[model samples]
Target: MRRRRAAGGSGAGRGLRRWAAAAALVALLAGCAPREGVEEIHYRLKWLYNVSTVGDLYALEKGHFARAGLRVNVKPGGPERDALKELELGHAQFGVASADQVLRAAAKGAPLVVLAQIFQVNPLQWIYRPDKSPFREPADLRGRTVGVTFGGNDETILRALLARHGIAESELRLFSVRYDYTPFYEGRVHFWPLYINAQAPIIGERLEKAGEPIAFLDPHRWGVRFVANSVITTREMLRQHPRTVSRFLAALLEAWREALDPANEEAAVQVLLAADRETPEAIVRRQLPVTRRLMVPEPPAAFGRIDEAAWRETEEILRLQGLIERPVDVRSLFAGNLP
Candidate 1:
């Protein structure tokens, strides 16, 4: 990682001032609010409006957060948004981030902590027209051209998967991918990274119309369990407003439970369609079930249950890949003490 000039002096001073201002503003606003007044909060998501954010969208639309006395302004994230940075700047009190983002931010001394684990199964996977190339097993990747974002978590995951399966780096062609999925559509890239529920389904429908079937290769299914999206907030926010944190989490988790329930499938899809108008209605409907499976794959386990083992495996993979020089204790970064 290249060192920014802001590492010290004026830059460091500015950052501290911003953080202090944010903290003070939160305290002042919280203290002055009436006992029954709804406290307005901002939530920064990991990506743009999509099915991946159905739980959040549902919560907001269904008045779950309102019942908890919180009026949250849900913000959309994209390639330009950094949830952790927004948290530090006090732009957002809470946000969603991946495990890799948390680990990297902590290594740089960011005062962030995990509030809840949303995705039990990481949806990051490679989608391919199985009939075209037939990616039935990890061994099939050999001699194939695979696409991964050069510095994204998917790179770490794909590398780990290859290493675990004893596939030499020299054997396969690794292609660095951008926002475009043209290569995959053109069949130049055999496998491409995408969220299983989001882009995969959209592409699958296109292939289906063209007489092709799509299948995804998940690292988690192959034993590389990287943690996915989780709720995050700054240490200062957690320390200063314990009740707010608890209420927010409770309502949010309950919202996820309700959204994933089979009875609420139609309502959940409707909420998502409202939030993401570009996604076809039928595609959003298809995505909801796949999103539910990834969010709460393990039965008997409640929604938002933090999988400590998955976090540990995520850290271990980063360490092996030389991403984290000194492993930050995964347990310490969690807000809820995991047993």
Candidate 2:
């Protein structure tokens, strides 16, 4: 009886050892699995994949977010897609939106927060033939036909520009502009509104190849500081996941700095090409430098640095234009004190 009991004990001990080893092996395999500690979040862009979103694409392609233990779903924005709405619907945690959009949403009681200002200078500018227009100042715009998308931000910006220069809308013809560049191409419109960083390269190349001298009329040069695209999130997201916000912004801004660096020009171009196959490589290359200049024109003006004065001007512009029903306190819109 004693021998039988000893054999049973040995078998039980072996069974216990085998069970422990199997559990340890399972734990080791789980540790090796991907996304164990990483948090996944969605980020919606203000526009489609283009030179404007180079840094965002670069961050994802270069593993910046992953290294920071974040799995980001970088989604594109377009005419049909509204990033702010996505945030409110809980479909996205972070998003990019123009200041006017933010102000309008805030006026409607959207609990949005601006995390960072992406473009130091607004990329929206008027492109024209320098030889034909000879625009030396805003006054030069008088007696000329200027193209503006009536219901779009360009019109608001154009009106603000005219107001700043004491030029009335009646002074120049406001040609209704659509996607077609026929009016501008045929010289029917003297100045056309297009994003300097995105559309300028393609259109400028076309004009230059045809021996036309081109120039850009910058609103920033004229002191119309209507703010542009910015990074945003909901107040609840900021409150609930402050650490994630910090990590995401840090990774994103760092990626922007690297993407805009002259040393990484080729890499940035490649990243843009990967995301935007429709844009030819040459045009993308051309677009990148302009984008860099718009986002970071010089030192002491850091990328993603919020210009509070610009925000105030943007809000005031929206209110005066009646785009928003009421004034949104621009100060309350920023999540500037994030840890």
Candidate 3:
């Protein structure tokens, strides 16, 4: 959904915008040619530029990938992009995709392997205005209009949440969400799905300005934990270019660590703003902390660490939802140690 802008007088916002603009220029020049002996690696993302991709941008801008002898072409993904399809067609050496996509691809005999888990907690959550018919529990969803992306992961997750709480589909209204947030803005929908870090800040800002504070209904908190974005590559690439995989993972993990570092907050946010000019600087600055929390949920949580249990749960959800007819050996897809 959409929301109005929130006013922020922080000087950090202006500083980041300037740095981001300069960094964009530098990246543009750097993309013109590869450094000597640097192998070109095409990495496709799951979606467009946002806080979700700060680590990827950080790695590119700070020479992390170049330091590993690779010139990565970080491509943005959208409705027209399918990372797994590109990987199968030999278009991209590496890409980011959700766990469900990997599982479904594996079930269909695509030799995809998970390299590292990006989000420790899934960022998909239903946002609602507390002043506008707040839901205290899952059963409270009965008779409420909930917006979900039809045939998307959110649809599956929301269904699972309903089943978990013994709430039947007939009791609630399931509205298909799209790029247009008119229905939500007009108060026709009680809750809407959005990436907590990407769209949440913008929606929350707008709603807050209208005197309606936004709150999120996280499925993870209610015991239905769906896995989010993770790094992926084909088994062929991992086996043939084992060295490249190792180098890429090392650099990538290091970049993620840097992006989540408190000292590097401004730098990371600036990189994201440079990549995605559509999002306001203030919104991006607010998203960085949320991204950090999802990336590293707790202390001693290593960056890029794969949570096996969460993977299993994701597979189960897909199977239960009949998204996949047969079970995919999700654990076998990972090589385990990541740098």
How well does candidate 2 score on lDDT at residue 96? 96
Backbone Cα, N, C clashes tallied per candidate: 0, 0, 2
CA displacement after TM-score superposition, residue 158 of candidate 3 (Å): 0.6
Show where candidate 3 strays beyond 4 Å: 1-38, 337-339
Each prediction's RMSD over C-alphas, in Å, is 3.1, 17.6, 12.2
Tens digits of per-residue lDDT for model 2 on 1-339?
101112334554554454344334333433443634225677999989999999999999999999888889999999878897677656677899999888876776667789989898899999998888899999999999999887888888998999999998798998999999989999999999999988999999999889999999999999899888999987666665677778899999999999999999999988988899999998888888888888884667778989999889988887777677667889898897433
Top TM-score: which candidate number? 1
TM-score order, best first, reads 1, 2, 3
Positional deviation of 221 in candidate 3, in angstroms? 0.5
- Check candidate 2 and list the clashing pairs: none
For model 1, the stretches where C-alpha displacement exceeds 4 angstroms are 1-25, 35-38
Q: Higher TM-score: candidate 2 or 3? A: 2
Better of 1 and 2 by lDDT: 1
With a 3 Å backbone cut-off (N, CA, C), the pairs that clash in candidate 3 are 3-206, 4-206
Model 3 Cα lDDT, one tens digit per residue, 214-315: 789999999998889999986656655677778888999899899889999988988988899998899888998988889885768678888899999999
Q: Which candidate is the best by lDDT?
A: 1
Clashes of 1: 0
